[model samples]
Target: MTASTANAQRFREFKMPDVGEGLTEAEILKWYVKPGDTVTDGQVVCEVETAKAAVELPIPYDGVVHELNFGEGVTVDVGTVIISVDTDPGAGPAAAPAAQQAPQQAAAAETEDAEPQGRQAVLVGYGAAPSSTKRRARKPQAAVPAQPEPASAALQAELNGRAAPAPAAAPAVTPAAPAAAPVAPVANGTGAGSAGRPLAKPPVRKLARDLGIDLAAIAPTGPDGIITREDVHAAAAPAAAPSPAVPAEATGPVSAPAAAPEPGLVDVAARERRVPVKGVRKATAQAMVHSAFTAPHVTEFITVDVTRTMKLVQELKQDPDMAGLRVNPLLLVAKAFLVAIKRHPEVNASWDEARQEIVYKDYVNLGIAAATPRGLIVPNIKDAGVKTLPRLAAELGELVATAREGKTSPAAMSGGTVTITNVGVFGVDTGTPILNPGESAILAFGAVKLQPWVHKGKVKARQVTTLALSFDHRLIDGELGSKLLADIAAVLERPKRLITWG
Candidate 1:
């Protein structure tokens, strides 16, 4: 209505971006900025879990946060505005639009008659719809007044009143002065006596519901008394225990494991769970299936004595050149694979189905398959072929750390030329690893075991392991694949060849 209001600040909406592999949607795992926080360009505003990885999204502009469009754990579609930022905070509030003014007036009227529901009011266009369940009656002494309390005091009163049970000797306060006087709710339900809502992300709340665990029963372990996923899982563990044995007549023999029930006969309330395939696990599954079916895989295995490689790993740990770096047999194996690629560059090629040609890579973007909590992700060391051994080790260490922390960026996992999966960590003998999509080869390193071997015509115990290399038949022939794998095996067998061949 006034000039000051006419020149009010305009809000800008920031949409969620596709963080990896053209992902369509991502769940908001955590929000860093609240409604009133100031944010700068490139400042990370929130962490989102996509189908590929957990990515931290950086705001592209400087502004004051106006409102969040979605709550934590809600999966927001790509290109949907997730947050609104006031670009010109110095400007005064804009006059409400004609359509919004009527709604705002109606909301205010509704608020006047509404009782304190012991939960924060949900912002429009965010969070789950309010439940239809009726609120329990308030205590006779805890009546709310017609007037609303100030925002800050109301928030504090709600927090303190709901945090724990009130003492029996506490004095009753009139509802009109609720803010200055803390009024406790009547104990009836699991969440009764709490004026504030339980602090939990959407996923944790969903987990609690799925496990039929009461959030109020579990003590909070997160910051500011928020319940975490671990806390909910801890509470569910005891309840998840199996029920009394089913009668033999109802099932089958008790000694033998019960047969899987017929499709429609399965119990709906069975103890077993069926977790949905989504996020990283879903993407990984699709990729593996495509790679397995599309590519004509040719796998070759070789048993090699890696005693020298094991000794070199120990020696490098003590070496000043490799001090403070990750020195492991995997490092040497990766280096050996790189050297072998140089010797047989044809193996470092990708088959371009669209162009119907072999694309040979001059430099290697060495990929290491990391098994993370999310799923199996292959993040590569960029320009690994050119990096010195120490630099390579450092990059490997950083890559593994980032992957483990679920912070591996989309860029880090892209453009991989070849991959090495260390299945040996799980004590696997060897595996025919499928090629990473677009790459020609993936090498599987098996566990090293002491086996009897002929040394200069005498039987002796030696550290031996098996290596399996799977490559694209279209781009890499049997001869080229064998030569490349043999070279890698030879380098590991001697360990000194890394210095000579490298």
Candidate 2:
């Protein structure tokens, strides 16, 4: 049926829009509403992560949330109807004559490529996603409002076909059942009125039910001498023996459930599995592959006597101002790179092949290449050149934590002007690092260890580390790369110089 036939009022349905350039789909990370949550136009309704980034999606209509089209973690094509606002449901489009004309006018006003009316348009670069053509499956209207049930109670019903009562839960007031009075002892086994068993709370009884043991059989051992999970387990152990034995024969004999099927003896292979490609893993893989191939990489390395840096690291960690901050060797190295990039600005520029020109970014978007189980993702700190030392250190910590947890989105990982990979975390001295795509340079920070070095023209013990710089040869020339790397080394050799240089 057409939207006009279904409702007299002109209501709008908001779908997932492609928010990034060259984007096709995004994962619905979360939904902030159910069927009936009242929402205003522009209020955040959901969060979606595309191959390029994660973004908060806002409601386009001010109305009650009539439906949520997809669950969290489901991938939706651009323009899919993810949410709908119930604007005067059943009133039909005729109810709002002016509103109907408005959409037609809006659609007519746009170019042929522009999105349809009543749908949110895809934003460019951190904007809304493109409109999807796929229609969402509508669910039947509920007889009553559905409230979220306790997880434990739901799990119990799934396993045993009976919902277990939660601890201290208020007695449910259903349409069929009258309000239950305070639970009275229902004597068991022996007699109705012979002081048959010790009285316990309703939850204690549920615990006994889940264990598949009689409540009267369990001996209470908690404060006020109530039964606990331990008590229930203890009482049920002997009864649990039968459950374990049934599985043994399924394995020992010609097994159907416990072991794999014999070559020719195939049973019904019943079940469908859908795997979702969303979140950090999807974002990371795309970013790494893009960076690896698109950016023409040229790596350069330098081994420096960083004894002074190590000493400074220790001194800073102990200082009252830096005590709470993470004063690591990598933090200092990242700071030094930020400072040096100012002098050799060419190293911080990107080669735009399509434009046939170098795009020089005045502000530094410093990315930290983080290795996560999903893949390698580089989430950067925006405008790092302007932040203080402590602020930079804190931002790095947050960036690393979010990337590792697979929570970093495409937006945070994109638009990086330069990148840093701390190879030192892997206990390696140094190796050439790849430049992140769309950026001109990547710096590798290597492990620091006591090594022999010449100090004041004599051989001596010194804290040493290696630094590697990989640049897009199409943009950054050898001269520019060397100057940037050397300047970083100079900062490490003389940590005190940054104060004077800045």
Candidate 3:
């Protein structure tokens, strides 16, 4: 039976449930199924990207997809219905196996008043029953019945060189509703039409808007005849689409775009781009500003002969214990820093203004500043003091890899008491490193190059590098900072100092 025919209560719409444990919000990365597509329970339905990771969400109901309540790239909080499903009548609560009834009982408790009670099949990850959370008073509104388009019909037409219908406007849903209401389906395209939908993922959709591209006009050439981003670029080449146009009145420029057909219809390319300052960069900026103003910074540099450290690195690389690791000078520098922090705990402390106390940590969480393609990110290793030299090197390698992939979680970037930025990797000698917001000290490691230096009162070629220490003078006085630098240098000058001093 058609969804419109079952208007009163025959069909069920399964909203997108909370997939991640205790997760409240997620960005719809991609929708794998459309209205009218058939899917079984456990079938991968959509991909959601939280602040944490990109996860593939599976279908909880074994039925035909009735509607997509949410669009891709939109951030919807937990319990928001992403799609609706029409379940088979025979698959009732009475028929579910006893072993599968556990989550249903929990679901009933959580979604007591909200979810339809006594439903049989539990969503794979979502609770077995509807939510029990009491909802606030809702405004008077009529529920939208489903449309008549057959499942996969419009999608199939798009793949067969026939133009798909223009997508209809989404329904006005109460943001507090369990699931979003699906937008009206567009009319099927006739004849050979050039119009098509964009092929990029949801995040890519946002990127295109920032870059200015219309999805409909872009032709499909990607897998499954989807319109790839490259297609959008080709279509947008002639007329550069600017940033998505915001309502002038809302932006305090109500007088702008007066001649346009409609505010939404305005050319995006003609609009200026504005980015919201949030996330890691915003946090970094605020912390840096606070540290720069509150803590008086003092920087000192020391040029050291590390001919022995370089030789040790080469020997460690060939050793069985350090096999398959990326052994380099930075690893030794990090180890040395840990040793120095032990001798001078003041460098691994923060000056708490409100508390009027200097907070010193007994353990070290080492932050490694890495410059990724996205931006500058410093994801740190937790409990670096506990790990062996080779183990620390491996952890450092993994940290760098995670940051590069933009997969660094907020937790990994937090609780760092000290930081080390290897400017040498970028072929630089040294830099006055900025102290990570809370911490009092940062160490910069320069490139190790063969230079003429005095070794044991004799002129000799040695592997030398420069170390720059930037400390918060309020916590670490010049004397303590200098001593810390000397300790680190002492370790690098002779690798045995780590065992002796540490």
Candidate 4:
């Protein structure tokens, strides 16, 4: 009670900010600071991954960290306090407030987030952000804990007093402790084990429950003995088990394609791994679905001879002026597309359903779709129409590098008017590209291959590639879309068009 209530003003709670375009949630990728660490104003406290991109969040003020409310890999609702700081640490010990106030704060937060007046729900695990203020009081949970373990569950995992049969590589309930069930609940707080309460975050606990893992039985391996996601996954993975332990619904899409492991040697289901979809992948899926269904998409394709463009690309690679830039077919194709947009500005417009109008953008935010370890993200270059070729190349390199590292900012990905997806990189010949949500058009550049062609009345091997343009038919008609695609092909066919048409 000391200073906890009396000096409550000393504790400053920092909530998760709306880090993306009205995104209601983000996952805690990592924490740079911890309780007792000093942090300054604008100091990065943690890195978070939203459905749009991964970004580092800086604390807005200075203080000594008092507590972190969540763990890594946990998706938290925006507006919920993620950390508490003792702004006036010298006044006295402020740690007691975290202990005394966590329950109250958690309750108040739940009520506030759940109130559906202005908030929008986002993502799956982020469902923690309730749609209603009062939670239903469910009582079966209490009664079930009082009952004995059923004989059917050979899943018992004992981390301390006894060891359960487990594959050598991963811990069973010894880490998840679910396999060690009958003995876990009374350990610390439901998550604690015989060794004291187990150290794990709420989302991790939820993962354990979904996988039928007992947290108390999990052996601690994370910093300060906290159980990590890998620990739970490992425990869930059986090396040579005859059958899968978790229910089919809980496991991720099993990757097993090989004929079912020879009967009895190894369980085919055991080879499966289920990774929860969240962050960028989940966002991209929802956006793609909405865009596909809402927009009346019309895709047009054109195969063009690019012998001159391919030759120019080689010359540019050897040019002393463009020595260090990323000189690739994509760079030239992007320039060609930009030139086309310059020739026809109306292609750079969006259909606003609410306003019942076609919004034309004065500036071009050119988006380049990049594939990263996390997922596909399209980060745009600002005011790209005005930049010189070299300057554009520099910005393009930075954007791609940033996206690949999974550090593209939400601001960089927003306000995009047009996009380009280079299917050529993956050796894809061509595809009916889909428009990025809110974008008017997307250009798909296919692989450039040497193919037989009639050149000046003679059969010869020439560089040829395909271009597919997808646009919103409601806003742009066939003629306008055809012109844009034609201009791109003309430029790529004759490199001089960048100067003439550009």
Q: Give the candidate number with the greatest TM-score.
A: 4
lDDT (10s digit) by residue, model 4, range 1-502 = 6655656667788999998879999999999998999999999999999999999999977889988988888788898888988888787644555444433343343346333332221211232222334443332222123222332122333233222332233322223222211211112322333333455655677778878987766665664345778778777776623333443323323455567556669665657777788899988889899999999999999999999998998999898888899888888898999999999999889988998999998899999999888888999999999989988988999998888888899999999989999999888889998889999999999999999989899999999999999999987899999999999999998989899877
Off by over 4 Å in 3: 1-291
TM-score on alpha carbons, each prediction: 0.67, 0.57, 0.56, 0.71
Cα error, residue 480 of model 4, in Å, equals 2.1
Better of 1 and 2 by TM-score: 1
lDDT per residue for candidate 1 within 1-502, as digits (tens), equals 6643543435667899988877798989899999999999899999998887899999987888887867787677798888877777776766542322433442343334345432232223333224335654554355544332344233333334432222234455656533433222322222222343555655567678867887766556664355778888777774554434544433334576678888878576666776767678888899999999999999999999999899989988999988899899999999999999988887878888898888888889999999998889999999899899999999999999999999999889899999999999999999989988989999999999999998779999999999999999999889999999999999999988988998
Q: How close is candidate 4 to the true structure, as a TM-score?
A: 0.71
For every candidate, C-alpha RMSD to the true structure in Å: 13.3, 19.4, 14.7, 12.0
Question: For residues 106-171, could you state the per-residue lDDT of candidate 3 as single tens digits?
Answer: 334333444432222232333322322334335544555444253233433433444334345666
Q: Could you tell which candidate, 1 or 3, scores higher by TM-score?
A: 1
Rank the candidate models, highest TM-score first: 4, 1, 2, 3
**What's the lDDT for all of these models?**
0.77, 0.68, 0.69, 0.77
Error of 3 at 295 (Å): 3.8
Better of 1 and 2 by lDDT: 1
Per-residue lDDT tens digits of candidate 2, residues 1-502?
7645655344567877878766888777778889878888889988787775457888878777766756675567787777767866545334333223433443343343333322321111212223335442243322332343455234333333344453454545455533332122222221111133433433345446654776554445653334555666676664343222222212223235567777988565434444344555676667667878877788999999888888888888888877577778888898899889877776678776787988877999999988776456788999999999889988888898887776676678778888899999889989977677688888999998888888999999888899999888888888888998999999999988778764
TM-score of 2: 0.57
